[model samples]
Target: MIRTVLSLIPAEYARLTPRFLAAVVAQAICQAIAYVLLVPVLKSLFGDDQAAAWAWVAPMLVAVVGVLVLGYLQSLLGLRIGVGMQADLQTRLGDQLNTLPLGWFEGRSAAALSHVVVDDVREVQGLVAYLLAKVIAGVVVPLGVAVGMLFVDWRIAVTMFVAAPVLFAVNSIAGRLYSWSDRRIHDAAVESDTRVVEFAQAQPVLRAFGAVGARNRALDAALTGQRSAIVRMVFTAVPSLFVFTILVQAAFLVLAYVAVERVTHGPLSAAAAVALVAVGSRFIEPLTQAAQLGTTLRSGAAAVDRIAGLLAEPALPESTTPVNPGAATVGFDTVSFGYETGKPVLEDISFTVPAGTTTAIVGPSGSGKSTLLRLVARYHDVTRGRIEVGGADVREQPTVTLLGQLALVSQQVYLFNRSVIENIRVGRPDATDEEVRRAAAAARVDEIAERLPDGWDTVVGEGGASLSGGERQRISIARALLKDAPVVLLDEATSALDPHSEAVVVRGVHQLSRGKTVLVVAHRLATIAHADQILFLDGGRILERGTHDELLTAGGRYADFWNERSRAAGWRLEPAPVG
Candidate 1:
């Protein structure tokens, strides 16, 4: 288990090795000195002429005071070092997580990562302080006691040496069982976390479907399972304690009998015999504590394994080449991709949008319209072929550099729990208040802002739940306008808006799209009727490419789609007015 934990230590912590080793050495020396001083004092207290040993009192008192002072200093230093180490661990973990690709987050739960970051890191400090300290104390203190016992009688020392191993063997067996139970407890904890997150995220849906009671019961079951596992782990330790107590008491009883016999029948002094029993009893305390701490260390090792597993997940590969795209043209060159292998969502597709023009992508559901936009943004790497932005292959470019050139507004907008101005500032983190207001005005969000109690400073609720759908969409568009990147990608950006809101957002889009490369994916053909060019996609293949008037004249997929959408919007084909 120690080997396993050692493997998990981050390379950045190598600098701390020397200090940690020094701390262990200091604790060992302190424990040994404490036990050595304790033995002579015990003998002196029981001397036949106690009044004559008054000189020993002063030295013993000084030794006790010194031990306490050293112990307190050690604790303070250990706590300081532990906290420093934990801070470093958290920083490293956070950095690693940030560097990882978005796909890594797709398969893992936020709650599980939260546990690793917050709970598991805390356990490391507890393990270092309690387990490492106790183990050092156990070794040095017991050795000191044994040396003291040898002066009294080698027989008692040998008896203790034999009994210690027997007790250890019993504890070792129990520790194995405890380790297994601990694993189950950890698993249950992760399950409980997952359930809580699921319940929280699905609360609205569950309530809408009248499944809240079922969700509550499921969460209850998860908690119950976690509790039961903890109970089993707690009970597993009881047997180890029971065995340790029996073995330790038996060893002391045997040592006491032999010590009395030696004092009465041989040259051993009575004071020495009593001190030998005192030393023997003292050994049991550290030994038992060490056994308990050993279990704690094992449990901590398990938590470390879990945390390390998360950190070990492969992060997004870093790009070495700098991307300096002179033009904002976006293109896909025979790209193929799938969330799962062998079932391509997009296959051998190719397209291009020239700089400073609007290119609309229209497709039926599941035709990979949004996926194509994601490809252009490089959110996920293609399984085959390459996508280029500004005439440079996206894979060769740093993700930051690639994404910096683009602004994205999707069907769903995620707003932070912050003021409207603060949320917009996420796009251009250094934008002035006036610039923010200008962007909001351009997106038509300022219309609503004027009536808000605090205007742009009004706090949006979590996920912007307090805002209307159109308000949120406009806020999202305002963020994009604030970014003012050379390229813009909009995926059904106005889907959630009412007709009036749609017009407001459409006007904003028109103003925002000027002199920028814009790629829009929309199911509503009317939204893209004015687009400079439209590409009609079906089954992940482009079937037609032209303007709305040209595609309508062609009488193909685009024409049929345009007609269907127009009819849905209550437009009647009035025989073209005999033109």
Candidate 2:
């Protein structure tokens, strides 16, 4: 565990480790000196050796002061190392997260991410602060005490050697029991955290179903499991701890018997016998502490494993021969993709989205329309064929260059916890305030922000909860407009809004996509009537392709879908029984 943790730290901090180790050793020696001097102090007070008592008092005072100074320095150094290591882990973890593929985030909740970023690192930080100190003291203090006792009487030291194996066996048993309970407890805690986040986010849906105060069975079960694990751990470990305490006491009993025998009838003086008894108590203290250190080190070891596992997750492969091509036309050359093997969501697809033209994709639910657009964006790379952006194979170009050439505006708009202007500015961090306002005006974002109490300066809550659905869509459009990339991808940009908001948002979308290579996953047929070309998709394949009116004239799947949506759009909620 010591070697594992030390390897994670920066090499510059290597000097501090030995410094703290030395200080802890010095502290153990000082404690022994203080305990040994107590014998002379006691003897002089009781007998006629007044000068001897005064002589021992000076050395005892010096030992006491030395221990206090060493302890202070040990803590200061540990704290410095812990704080530096925590920040370094955060930096390393952040860089690793960026390189991971978006598919890696699937099925991982906000709670799990928070656990890695916060809790796991914190456990290692605590190991540096307190557990490392205990471990060093456990090793150094006992050895120091045993070495001194051997010189006085080798028989008394032999008792400690016998007790060592017994102490280790009992501690090993207790550690195994605690470890089993702790694993269950940790799993339960992670499940409970995930449920809490889900329940809070589902508050609006739960209220609609009249289940606001109702129990969530998954969450309740996880909490109960955590409580049971804690109770079991206590019951199993407490008695075992008492057993360990008795084993340590047995060693002390043997030392007491020998010290008495030497003082009464053999080769020991009264003061020397008293000194062994006093220092013997100090020897037993570290043995008891060593038994508990095993569990503490095991916890730090588990946390280290979790952190190391995440760092080892593979990054998306980068191109050795990176390219920068000229045109913004996108081509899908027999591309295929799937989240899992043997179940391809998109297969053998081929098409072109030309520069400065709108190509809309129309399909029913589960037709892979959205997955098609995601491929061009490289959320996950093609499983079989290659994708082209700016006329170069996306795999051949650097990821940054591919990202720089396109802008995505989807229905799910995520904003930071910052002022309204700042969320819109995420599109181009270096854009001037005036340029931001220009994009906002074009995308109709300024209208929403100006209506708020603080106008452009109003703070949007996490995930843009402070803004309405239409407002967030407009904000996302403004970001795309500000970016001014050559290619634009839209996923049902106005699918979730009312007719009034849809019309206004559609106008904003037009402003953003004008004179750019545009690909849209069209949900409402009416929105794509004037598209330059329309591809009707079903079951991962394009069934028909032509202009909107051209597909309608053919009386195929596109025509049937168009007629159904057109009729549904005209339906109204009114009193039918009045006639």
Candidate 3:
């Protein structure tokens, strides 16, 4: 545990660690000295040596003062290191998250990460600020006193040495048990938190389906699991604590018995034996603290393990000498990918989009349409082949340079809780207000602003809940327009809009894609009928590749898909006769 904490401290604060530990050890030594002096002081006073008793008291007072001063310094250093360590851990986590592949952030994974950053970091911070100091003192003071006892009475010292190891072994076993329980409870808590967030976010759908309240089985199950885990933790903790406490008491009893037996056997005087018995509590006190602190230290160790695990997650390898792309073309050579091994999502897929040309991919649900666009953007590296943008392998190019070369408008749009104009400016942070307004006008976001209560300055709620779906899409389109990169990737950008809104958004998309390398995932076949090239994808492979007219004439899978969609387009509901 000590090694884990020292490894986590930031470089700037590393020098303070040795100083802090020295202070802790000094304080523990002084404490043991003051306690040991009690035995000699009592023995002298009982023997009627007033001068010798007073002599011992003087140095004992000084030792007590030393304990106080060193303790103060240790606390100051611990606090400084704790605060710095917390901030550094948070920063490191942020940096790691930035380098991780985007596909790793699934819902449960995100929730668990959030818990680690907030709760686990705080727990580990407490380890340095409080528990670490206590732990050092607990061990150091006890060992120092046992050695001190050797000078006063070897039999008592030997008894303490024998009991110390037994007590330590018991505490070690109990600590492991508590740590295991802590990790289980931590996982269950994260799972419960994920379910609660899901329940809240999905309220609209749940209510529409009449599955709200008691009918929401996922939420109920999650909460039940959390309760069960906590109950198990309590059950595990109580027995471990009970056994540890019993062992601590037994050790104290054995030490007291040895001191009394020494006086009976004529190896020690009554005054010395009584003093030994009195001073024995001081020896056992540190051990008792160890027993009491065991659970807390185990919990902190669990938190530290979580932090270490997150920091240990592998980041995508970045190129040492990054290269720049030479063109705006995109190509995939026999690409294959899967979220998990032995289960491929895209297999042996190959395609190329020439510079300044438009290619549309149409496929059934789960046919890897969206996955194709994600791969081009390098959201995840290819499993078997290479993806190139502008004739440069994406893996060889710096992430910033690769992302800067293209504009993406995915189906799932996320907007910050900021003013409408502010959200639109995210595409180009340094863009002038005039430039932002111009892009908004092109995307028809101006119409949305006009309807909002505060026009362009209106604060959109979280995820743009304040605006309609079509309004959010318009704002998204405005962002892409402002970016004005050489390449564009649209993942069904207009799928959520009405016909009128869709037409307006399409016009904005056309304006944005003019003279750019465009690759689109199109669900509406009619919308992509005029695309320069079309690829009919299904089951992770392209079954047909040609112009829309050529695919229709071939009378294959694309022809059948197009005919079915055309028939569905003209279908209408008829009024039924009254019963």
Candidate 4:
């Protein structure tokens, strides 16, 4: 455990910097000097025959008071420095999280990351401040007292010196045991966090399925693991305390025997022997402090490792090229993509949506229609070929620049717990209140807002659970309308709506897509029927492509899918009327 803790000290020191170390060292030295100087005056006070003893007593009191004042000031300085360091670490961690690839977030548990960033980081601050101060004071003060002991009597000093090796060996073994248990405890904490998040997220489903008892059992299991780990940690620490107490008692016995022998031989004064006993009794204070600090240091080192791992996650390469989206034309040039190796999601997909036109992609489930739309927004890079906007590869353009040219309204709308107007403003932060209201009206969100408590200022619960699905979709559309990007990507924008609501949202979508390049993953036949171009995808390949009328005439995958959907919706399949 000492090895792990010692490894973290250099990192903490480096992070805190030389100035903080200097302050801590200066404080420790001052405290040690105060103790050494007070010993003599304290010894003088013991004498029965006083020759103006108040003179020495007053000076000693003043010096002790001065040391206390300096120590308080140093503590305040260390606290400020620690808070500042923690703030810097949090900022860096937040920035690193944003820069990491989306897939990194997919693989990790959000609750575990949350615990490390919040709870673990806070622990580090306490550990760094308390353990560092204790270690410094423990080493300096103990060494000063040992030197003072030698001045009183070399025999007592020799006993302390001889006992040092035994103390080191005991502490070293205890430290290793503490470290092993501490790591287990930290892991259990992370697991508990993961289980809590999972449980909360699954509560609705669990309740729907009447599986609350099952979930409770799972939670109990996680808590049981955490309790067991903590119990093991206590077992490791309790034995160390026993050993430390025994060692301190043995040291006192040796000092007492040596003092008696010296007094008998007339080599030590009686007052000096009494002072040596007083100092020897307090000698274990530093060693005990150091032992407790070892545990804190070990826990802090584990936290540092977790934070470092988060920061080390891969980030997308920075782009230097500026984007000039001349026409908002989106084109896929032989693009191939796979979420995993040897199992392609989209293979050799190629298509183009010209400026000021709507292009609909129709496919069965898992046919990669949404993936293609994601590529246009550059959510994930292509594995092969290129995705270009306005005649330039997206990979060559800055991500901010690429994103600025497009607005996305996904099937899954994620709303923050904020006022409706503020959520809309996320897409265009500088938009005026009037502008936001206008967008909301245009998206037909006003229909739902009229029933809301405060209209546009009404707070939507997390994920917009306060509103119905169709209402959430309208708010998402309002956000996109507010951004007013030249290119719009809609993934089942109207899928959440009832027929009447769908009509309202579809009209709004039509208005929003005016004079802009729109690429839609079409779930409704009505949405695709109006598209100037339609791409029929099957088995990760573009099986057919043409205008809606041309594809219907071709009577291939598009016709088959249209017929199947038309039958499912109970729509009559009739011949096309003369135009």
Candidate 5:
């Protein structure tokens, strides 16, 4: 536990380390002095010099003042350190996450990441601010108090030591048991939270299906599991705590017995015996604190380990000598990738989108069309072979530089909870308002902007929920148009638009993609009918490739798809026969 905390303390806080150490020692010493002064006071009370009692009173008061001043400083410094660590951890995590591949994030739940950064980090901060001070003082105070008692009477010190082994043994076992239970409870709680969040997010669909309870049964089960785990932990831990309490009382009883026996054996005066018994509570108090504090520190260690795991996850390695592509040309040479090993989504795939030409990839659902576009965008590295842009292998180019050369517009567009103008400006942050407005006009975003009360400044609610699908689609196209990258990856970019908006978007796309390398994943055969080349894929391999006219004349899969789609376009609901 101590090792975990020391590793978490950043190097910049090195100076604060000694300051806290001093505070802990000062606080502990003051407490020991306050308790030790009881001996002198008791001696004064029974001795002939009754007026000398006033001398012991002043020093006891001084010790009390010292404890207060040091304790306050310790808390203030500890809180500042805690807050600083929290800020640092958040910043570091964010910076690292930005550099990670999209594939890494795809395998993890958003709820799990949020819980780790926001919830678990806060709990760890609390451990440092509250539990740490108690821990330091708890360890130091007992040792200080024990040394003072030894000077008063070695026999009494020996008696206190008799209970030391028993007290420590019990505390050690309890701490281990509590830490095990804490980790289990922590995991259960996280699972419960993840289930509730996922369930709530899908509530609209669940309600429409009238399967709210049935669909969310897993959430119900997760919560019930958490409750059962917690109840079981309580039943097991309470008995261990009872044993700890019993041992503490036994130590106190043993100290009192030894003190009376010493007086009977003439090893000490009556005054000395009374002082030994007077400060008996202070001797065992620190050990009791340690027993309680151990649990919290151990939990903090677990949180630290979790955060460290995130930081340690390998980021996509960048090229040391990065190269710039000579042109916008893109090539996939025998590329293969999969979410899971041995389950290749695209295998031995090879293709090229020549500069200043359009290449359309058509495939059935789950046929790796979208996955191919994502690879060209370098969201994930090719697992089996190489991908090149401008005759240069993508792996040789720096990720940031590579990203700057391509603009992707997918069917599902994402907009921040910001102004309509700002959402469009995401394509190029440095673009002027006038430039953004020009792009918006080209993509027909201005049509929607005119309907809004605030035009460009209108706040698009979270995920642009306030806007219609066509309006949002236009805005996304406007952003892509503003980017004006050399290579454009259009993944059914106009799928959400109405017929009128779709025509306007097609014109804008033509303008944006003119004289650029274009790789399009087109579901509708009509949209890519005039593509420079078309690759018809099925079962992760390109089955046929040619111009639309050639493919139709070939009377293969493309022709079959075209005939089916054409028939699907003309189908309508038929009137049921009266029976």
Candidate 6:
């Protein structure tokens, strides 16, 4: 357990560990020496030697003072190292998050990550700042006392050594019990946190459908489970602690019994026997403390294990020698991918978008249209083949170099709670105010801002909740326009908008896509009739490919799809015939 925790400490903080431990050791020795001095002082005083007793008293006082000073230094070091370690751990976790593939985030809840970063890390911080020092003293103090007793009385020293293993066995049993309970408690807490966050975020939908009561049942169950786990832990802990404490007292009594038996036998004086009994009492004090600290040490170990596991998660591999893209062309060579093994979402797909041209992916639902676009963006590496961006394999290019060449505007737009203009500036932080406004005007975002209470300065609520779907899409398009990348990828950006808003956003899309390498996932066939090339996909493979006129003339799946959509467009509701 000690080695596992030390492995996670950053090098800078690990360097102070030796100094911190030395102080704890030195303090434990002083405390043992002070207890040993009791034997000599009491024996001398009872023997009627005032000068010898005073001489022993002076050094005992010095040992006590040493203990006090060393303890102060130990605490100071622990706090300094603990605080530094907490910050470094959090920073490392953040860096790890940045390097991970986007798909990794898809499988985890935000609440689970939050609990690891906020709650588990805080527990580790408590370990070093407070619990570690006490736990160390509990160990070293008792061992020091046993060694010191050898010179004072060999019989008592032998008794303590004999009692050591028995005490350790009992303490170990208690620690194992507590560790089991702590793990369950931690799991329950994580579930409770996840349910609470889900409940809070889904309030609008829950209330709208009158399913709030249904959701409340899940939350209540989570809370109840957490409460039950905590109660079980407490019940299990008290009995173990009580058993360990009783065993410690029993060991002390055995030591006392030995001293009394020796006094009645030959060669041991009454005064020295009395002093030996006094020393025996001091020996049990640290032993009891160690048993009490068993739970704390186990808790710290559990927290460290959680932190190490997260840090050990693999990050996406990068090229040793990254290549820079030379053009804005995107090519897929027999690409195949899936979120899980043996469940391919795209299979044997091949397509290319020449520089300064547009390719529209048109398909039914679940046809891997958006997944194909994401492959070009390299959300996850291809499972079977290669994806090329700008004439170079995306895997061989630096992430920054690849992302810098393309701008993505998906249907689900997320905006931080900040001013309207500030959100647009996210595209290019170095862009001037005039440049931001220019893109906003091209996307018609200026029209939406004019009605906001604070105009361009108004804070768009979290996830742009204050804005309508069409309004958010306009801001997203404005962001893409500000980026001005050589290639643009749109994932059905205007599919859910009203006709008026669709027209407004389409004009912005045209401005953003003009003279760029474009890959668009089109839901409405009419929108992409003029695309340079169209791939009609179904069941994870492209079944038809050509220009709209060519596909219509061929009378394949694409032609049938177009005819169906054209007929749906002309349908209208009519009153039923009178009965």
TM-score of each: 0.80, 0.84, 0.95, 0.79, 0.86, 0.90
Q: Residue 495, candidate 1: how far off, in angstroms?
A: 3.6
User: Can you list the residue pairs that collide in candidate 1?
Assistant: none
Of the pair 1 and 5, which is ahead by TM-score? 5
Best by lDDT: 3
Candidate 5 or 3, higher TM-score: 3
lDDT of 6 by residue, 215-237 (tens): 57878898999999999988998
lDDT of 5: 0.82
The TM-score measured for candidate 5 stands at: 0.86
**Please, what are the lDDT tens digits per residue for candidate 5 over residues 380-490?**
888899999878887888887788888898888888889999999999999999999999998888888888999889999867878876788778889988988899989
Put down candidate 3 lDDT per residue, 1-579, tens digits, no spaces.
Answer: 899889999998889999999999999999989989989888887766767899899999999999999999999999999999999999999999898877677444667989889888998988998889889888888788889998888888888888888888878888888888888888888888988887876777889998777898888888898899889988988798898788878878888788788888866777777788778889888888877888788988998998998899889878777686788999999999998899999999888999999899988899999999988878889999999999999999888888898899988888999999999999999999999999999999998889889999999987887877778888999999999999999897665678998888888888899999999997676557978899999999999999999999999998898888889878899999999
Q: lDDT, candidate 4, residue 234?
A: 88
The residue-by-residue lDDT of candidate 4 on 516-569, one tens digit each, is: 899999988888998999999988999999988898899998999888888888
| Best TM-score among the predictions, by candidate number | 3
Candidate 4 global TM-score: 0.79
Query: Model 4: which residue pairs collide?
Result: 1-176
Q: Which pairs clash (backbone N, Cα, C closer than 3 Å) in model 5?
A: none
* lDDT values, one for every candidate: 0.78, 0.81, 0.88, 0.77, 0.82, 0.87
Backbone collisions counted per model? 0, 0, 0, 1, 0, 0
- Which ranges in model 1 have alpha carbons more than 4 Å from their true place? 1-20, 33-66, 129-131, 143-218, 228-273, 291-299, 338-345, 362-368, 528-579
